[model samples]
Target: MEAGYLFLVGPFAYTKLGKRANADTMDRITIFCFVASYTLALMLELLHSWRGLIAARIGALLSGLAGLVAHTLFLYSKQPPLIWQFSWLLFVAWVLVVAYLTGAIHYRRLTWGIFVLPLVLALVGLAVLFGQPPERGLWTTYETHTLWGPVHATLLLLASVGVCVGFLASIMYLFQAHRLRTKATPGTGLRMLSLEKLEEMNRRAIWAAFPLLSAGMIAGVVLLSRSEVVSWTDPRVLSTVVLWLLFAVVLFLRIASFLRARQVAMLTIVAFLLLLCSLVLSHNQPTGG
Candidate 1:
């Protein structure tokens, strides 16, 4: 049972099984309930795209809220009194879903669902597949116990969510751009955010996310500086540095001149994908000596 308190300080788990953790011990009903809720919500959103129905919007809202509630319950059930196993990347996914839900309610815009739900589904899928309970004989390393760990974690998580929201906005921008360029009529079922608003959101997500991610990477670099347990040469560290630089370029270009909105959107997508890959590499690290 001691092995089960996996993320002592951080929200990551490392083990020898490598590719993905064994998920047999997880709570299936909670998983199923939230997954089904999000899936149904996504479907309703798609239906709105096709039919332009307000009822579909209402259904999607209710479904997203239900999913959010189930997600909270799932986490609560796993988090024993003071023990902090809340470090799963799925927790990031949950935050994104909650943010998406919040955006849906605040904006009252169905198009938000079109671009955001797929990513939410992907994050939830990762949560389902790899968010397993640690086994009795599991090989592991705890990254959360240090003072800097939670700060490192919170910044990275916020950055990731910001990038994700930005990504969705980018998709929206592209959709809006396409319609504008081709003079195509929006389908009766689809209502998109204005190009101006989508562009603004894309810009805001990056402006906010890049600095936080960079700070998180810097904190890790500081940790490596004070010890020899891990190397700066580690793929995770190097890739994040590289990821930070890439976004820095985006941030610079975004602020400097007439960098087209389309280019900025594309860059954000690339940066997010790179971050995802780095996370996958970190997730699969061999923890055994």
Candidate 2:
């Protein structure tokens, strides 16, 4: 669990670099690293299930190094430093890797990579495709001149990453629940987390993410108010509000169903998905400032 959490943190810490580096190269490296590590971890876990801890630890270490190397290469390739988004992205990736490894090895949990990898690829692809040259004029001017602008954006991006975690947790919880209710054994390709753990994770992720997300939204509003070129009606602003509201509802329901763990977990999952949709929409929307 500690490893998984750390892995996720490392990637988000480096998200800003996503747009600064060679996206295709970085994407390939990341995908390769994750798949390699995941495979090794699975093999080790299988050995441990038969041969015991020594074999498992060795496998984990080797896989960890492979993951680290891939991560280091990806980070080093970013020429000019990006705003803190780069660090955050790295932190996020690290955490995901850790989660996948730990879940697979220790708990024999479902292979979350099946769901998560494609999302990572999509994000990287977006960075490669639309992340090119900043638009000229007011928005660009605001971004470059306002020192606080990048900071604000970085905070929002991190918040979005947190929401992504919540989304992942929710999906996992649903799958696990469905498996339990159906009396089906988990497949070899995937390991299902216990319903209790999944629900707990979903709850915790939502609670933690809500505040960070709220801070990001507040920073954005402040930026809009202070900026000369930007307005509250900007698509970014409106979309942020929409995302904020979705998270707010998730939080509200979370508090309301503090006792109903299952319900809270399902709602958290829904809210996170909605949050993701809002982010995609915002990313695609053009900004005129």
Candidate 3:
């Protein structure tokens, strides 16, 4: 349990390092170590569930340490390691943990885990399956004058996370709504938020995320226009434009339904689904991938 807690803490500590100049290497190494540790711990827990062996527990702890050492060695040898990739992984892990811990989701939501884990596994699997390649010369053509690219990416990622929360909220809302409609007592294992509160939370998350997403999309367009490497006609570019339009229309409809909170909540849910679909499509696209 302590080891699992540490595994969770490591990623957040590394994220805080984003503010410092010499923090890149340390942050990357920390994230690599944390993932490796968490994976080991999870494997051990699974084994323990299966075999009920003390040695398996010990193996879990030792594997975690071994992973840390391996990651350290890998980082030491690579020149100017690609830190951002590691950071992204850490951030995603942090969000998942937060979601689980908050009771915003229940343990039975392992099905949700089944949905998200494959994506995370695919990313980590890609990293392990393909060794790091040599760094090419600085692609100045891709660089833009706006310092906003990183900000935009960060905010968009945050907004995406918020949308995920909204998704969960919607699920809970629907579950509770169903119970009310049928006059069924709530089940013991699956606890859900009050319909009113869930709706409030869903609406708030959308309201907060919309502005950040809008800013990110606008800044992204500006940055791409200034960057010679990116073309306006690129499928990736067009997809983003389409996504933004969808979100914008959703936003407009949500605001128009100011008097009807239920309508707003439903619109938020629909918008989040559209955004998620866009993300999946974009990620699967050759240019975006």
Displacement of the residue 225 alpha carbon in candidate 2, Å? 0.7
Ranking 2 against 3 by lDDT, winner: 2
lDDT of 3 by residue, 1-289 (tens): 2232223223333433235444555445643564566575556645654565567656654654455454443343232222133333334444544443233134332223222333334445544433343332331323212354454556566666666666666666776777788877654323455788878777777767778777767767777767666677865566656656755675677678643655555655676556545444444221121
lDDT of 2: 0.56
Candidate 3 yields a Cα-based lDDT of: 0.50
Model 2 / residue 120 / CA error / Å: 2.6
- Worst 10-residue lDDT window for candidate 2 reads 78-87
Please give the ranking of all candidate structures by TM-score, highest first, separated by commas: 1, 2, 3
Clash pairs of candidate 3? none
Q: Candidate 2 residues 1-289, lDDT tens each? A: 2232223234344444345456677656644565466556556655554454565656655665576567666655432122223343444555565555555456543454455544544444444443533332322444434544555555665666667677777787777777777778655335656777777777677777778777777666776677776577766566667667777876776667654666666666666555545444545332212
Which candidate should be chosen as best, given TM-score against the real structure? 1
TM-score for each model = 0.82, 0.66, 0.56
Q: How does model 2 score by TM-score?
A: 0.66
C-alpha local distance difference test of each model: 0.69, 0.56, 0.50
Whichever of 1 and 3 has more TM-score, that candidate is 1
